[model samples]
Target: MAPAQAQMGTIFLLFIGISKAINDVQMLKPIDLSIEVLILGEVLLSWKPNVNPELESYVVKYNVLIKTPMKEEQYTTQNNSTKRMVALHKGLCAQVCAVYYEREKETARSQWAKAKLQAPPGANGTSITNLSCVIYTEASNNTAMDCSWLPGEEAPEDTQYFLFYRYNIHLEECQNYSRSHDGKRHSSCQFAKTDIQITEDTIVVIYVNGSSKHSTIKPFDQLFNPSTIERINPPMNITVALKQESLCAEWMKPVSVWPSPCFTYEINVSDWVTGSTKQLTVKDNSICLLTNSQSRYSVQVRAAGSDLCGNSKQWSAWSKPVFSDKPQKASVLLLLFLVYGALAGIMLLSAVLCTRFQLHRRLFPQVPAPRNPFKDLLSYNEAPTEGALEVISDIDDPEPNE
Candidate 1:
């Protein structure tokens, strides 16, 4: 009886072993393969697990084959994860299979479950093209800078964008931005304003990523320096003063992503009434005009990065205009002449009056007085000179009769 029982047990064990071998040989392939494209140039893959319980027991891992326009690569994961993430590109394809191992060697693999890569819904359906950055500094705020870009072609109307930057050993996302006048979204973002370091060896690189309800998910990267895309701010606080008979313009250097000393400036002076303009360039912030004949003048200041900083060709937008008033040269000369003529006329009149007074004094001084005839007649009668007394008596008698 003991030997019979032992033989039976042996037969049972062999049958069990045969059953496992059959299951291993017939391992079920994964099904329902799917792929999702993600930002950061990655793809997510998922599949349905095999349904056979006996086959599932022998399954140790999943093997994925990825194909791109450039090359193909295979990845094996020990974990029975239904999903995996891998690098992705355009025209990407993936196939997943259940891997069965026996004695540390692949015994069986399910048929390939193929999946075509696709962008997520609401994402830009295409990769970004012509990606670029324009870096600029704001004079009103000296601590931070803004980087801006235009959206690529086929970008959705409701698309929203975000920017990230890497410099030297630091990497971070840009958080702040300048908005439009109506508080609408703008295509720019701001970097760190404080507690950071910038050096010559530091290389600044920017990444722009965008998404929408109907667009693909991808990030566009650009490598650059502050000077490469540097757009200097317009000169600030433009001032005009009348100094030493000339119009003098004084301004402050634009706050810049680069040093203030790395900027060159341009000044434009225009006479609105005369329809003339004068333009000049300078390394400094001040300009002095020897003379301007126009009464109504306007000045605008602009700037560009100097060649020392590797940006010397482009100029910034003109600043808010500064207006000045000065009397025209012809008008000033006429006023001066009129004042001199008035002074000369007053002096000549005084001289003429003095000459006339002197002439009158010399010509009319000590004129003699006329004698009275009645007094002469009375004196002659009293003196009794015969002929004079007779003439006086006759004249006095004739006067009394008349």
Candidate 2:
């Protein structure tokens, strides 16, 4: 029984020594591990050697394992030296372990030092394809712009995309995003009114790009003038009329621009007969009067944002021309001449009729020779006498008395 107890005690000591050895190996983990993004999807990993003196002497190199959503990579570095892993994407986690050589035979790994990688500055990739933008002015006169694009060629399903813009000297990323039908992120962005710069010489530029675990593209960039795109709809439904001696033109504002007051118009007037053209600028949509009323005239209108608002310097497309003809003076002169001639002819006819009537009465005189019918009858029965007093009675009853 004593010999059996001695053997068990020795075995217990051996187990305790093995546990100590395992504990020492576990405590050889690297200290002060940290990660930083240096440049171009490359990460710099740094750590310090273990504080244990014996473990530090045995350490030979460090092994790095960078795990990404797409794949994992392994790297080796000299002991106590920082390791740089290239071609890394965002959402990367790093695991590092101290490699120690045991008796010049094999390498042993320490505990892992894990971290998530930082994103590289800006989007990396080739130019995005089929990028388009337009001002989104709703019926309520809201000032906003929408931009969209297709992803880069052969972009993986796990690829991520981002959009940014530059106007003048300022550069910024688009924060107002619109989602796809499934509520997932899409390759579209909205720029509000406040994001726009409306200087007299404003120039806007946009860039789109994508990134994946192993690759990035050269960013695709484009430049634009907001005025050239916004308010691009031509003036609509123009009407022209003759206003007294001048040509009048009226048109409705473009439906593509917002806040009607922000627009200014250019009215172009041309003479069809003379082939001469005149241009006029007005804040309103109508030109009250145009010059050169003697010839037939045509008018066209276009609009742009004023300095008080969008400050768009570029003019939109012109409206379809409208035409008007001025009244002629020859017709009025001919009408007056006809009216005067008619009046003069009527007056002359009245004068001629009055003169003829007077002349006829003067030329033929009327004479009176008898005063009564009985005198006429006595004259007829008696012979021709110069003058006589004659009386006649009723023929049947008073003949004896006469």
Candidate 3:
């Protein structure tokens, strides 16, 4: 009887194992994916878990996919809920599924659960087009965000447009606005020292909307990660000098909140003598080139944040040019001296030879005319030369008689 009871107990344990294996392989689907609005342009996604007590020891993770007209993103996480900040003006859809896995392989996967938010109602062509934005760090450590857009063709003339930004939990309405030249129609907005905290994330959302009596104006929103639209500042205090025969340039980093190490520079050297321009990109603040020192150059430096900080896509405008000392005036002075010295040397030699050899008198000796019989008939105004010829004869030594 004892052996029979023990055998029965073994069979019962085997039956329980078979049932558990069947439960583990059963396909469980997730339920009710939902989006909970947290704030403007932000939402929380939550769903019911596909739990199985039998698979307690195995790890279960959820795969979430968010889709938009422009792009789609997919990620896996162990949590059933996630928080996201995204542009909602165009609307988005999200889907989630449960994945059951062990240390080695996936045992099972649940079906997908989907949720969607419909786009706001408006005419297709009434939404503003060509929206762009730029963010910059001011000298006072303040952050400014500038955005501009073109009016939609279908939009009404008197439609009043407004710009707003959402950062984390804060939403700001742009108070400083710029109007188009044709009319008082708003076309651009600037946020000076935005109360919205500056951060390195894709959470910042810029939204533009308007009210119109003629038709419903569609709103527009875009996500920014801070670096994409940032406009770096030009490098500061560019100084150029010749160092040990090298053309060297130096400058401080741009006026930004980031440290010097977080920036790189682009240096432009324009040789006015050779009429050639050279450009160098360096991670360091100072650069030296073995260039023609005699060639005067105009150098300018521009800076951008590096990957160490948030790298910028746009480079700053070029800084004011700094000129190196004009090729030394000493070279010109030396050339003039050599030319004058040669002329002076010739003059001195001529003077010495003239004093020693009476050169001028030998080359331009006075000639005496033959005594003419007619000279007696000429007037006495002509000076008599009969005795002058004998005095000039001594200037030339008499040659030896042949």
Candidate 4:
């Protein structure tokens, strides 16, 4: 009986030691760990499942503890929900702890992860509420002649977000300016003088910073001065008409007048035959009338003023010669009449001779009878019937008898 009792006691002691060892293994199991931190104005902390075969749920604890050279501060808060880990703290230091669990068993808790949170080096703290321009130009004749913006400390990595200009004719100068708002690289800008005709009063200038949201505004001066004329093209047009006593001339304006302003025009008229010239100046109109009636004349117009930059517009194409009608004599008429009469007489005589010849041919159409042959053979006193045969026979018989 004593030996059986001693054997039971030894078995009991061994069983208790084995149960403690299993509990110790469960507590000391190595767990996986993952941590993430983000810094804005405040530090943001997040975590993922640290176990293989991911846990169904997790419990997260976060705290900000700082150990500076001068002092220390602890900021710890328990977030005991069974969800993924996410936390935010606006303090100097942060600590995150997560406990993962499966559906059937409680997994081990991960080791604490610590982080320090502080403001960025150059945090200004004040947001740019608004950005705009103060002064701008909007006139038609007077342009936004020149423009500029405030310079920056450094050149921006990207130049697209630099300053720009806007011109609006309807609204006030202050309302026309707009700035960029995208968070791109920043750059500085300068202005260049331009040649334009602005007739309105207000102009606006816009200033843009690196982040685009930060911008300012400024007003521009109103330009009302007269525009400068450069040069004319193709010159002008001039024409002349002859009246009874005087030569009337007209002209057209220069076609290529840049920066147009009010102008005074003058014309120089000269007579080619008489060797005399006259000058006539007219107001802001292009046309001019000259009244020096002559047989031959030439006229030209020139525009001159202090507001013009270059020489006066050249004179127009020359005017044509003008002349009056003179009376013609009657001697040429008499000579023409005499020549016509002589031609008529020669034609009449030819017609008369031709008519007489036709009449004679019609009256004597028959051939004339042959002349009497025996009558022409005898002399004027000889008888027409004479027998010479008897006399010839008597003369022959007498010669035979001898």
Query: How close is every model to the real structure, measured as TM-score?
Result: 0.44, 0.35, 0.76, 0.22
Residues 1-402 of candidate 3: C-alpha lDDT, one tens digit per residue: 999999999999986785578465766767878987777777799988876666667778998999888778899988889987777777889999888776656766777899998887887677778989888888887889899999888898878789888876678898999999986678999988875444465457888888888889988888887766778889888888887678988899887767788887888999887899999889999989987756778899888777787658467999998988745553466679999999999999999999899999998898998988776677556676776533344477889999
Per-residue CA lDDT of candidate 4, range 1-402, in tens?
Answer: 999999999989976775454335422222232223331111234433233333323333333334433345555445321121121122244445544443433344445655554422211322121232221122232223222233233323233233444333222222232233453432222222233332223223232323323432111112122222122222245555555555555555444323335344666666665787777777443433444432356666665432334333333333343332210122345557778988998888867876868754676577899999787667555644665333324444455654
Determine which window of 10 residues in candidate 3 has minimal summed lDDT.
Answer: 385-394
Best by lDDT: 3
lDDT of each: 0.67, 0.67, 0.81, 0.39
Comparing 2 and 3 on TM-score, the stronger one: 3
Model 3 spans > 4 angstroms off: 1-26, 50-58, 195-199, 326-402
Model 3 lDDT at residue 352: 99
Per-residue CA lDDT of model 2 for 59-125, tens digit only, reads: 3677888776656788788755554434343456787787766566334567787777654344444
Question: What's model 4's lDDT at 107?
Answer: 43
Clashes of 3: 0
Q: Rank the candidates by lDDT, best first.
A: 3, 2, 1, 4
Clashes of 4: 32
TM-score for predicted model 2 compared with the true structure: 0.35
C-alpha RMSD of candidate 3: 10.8
> What does the lDDT come to for candidate 3?
0.81
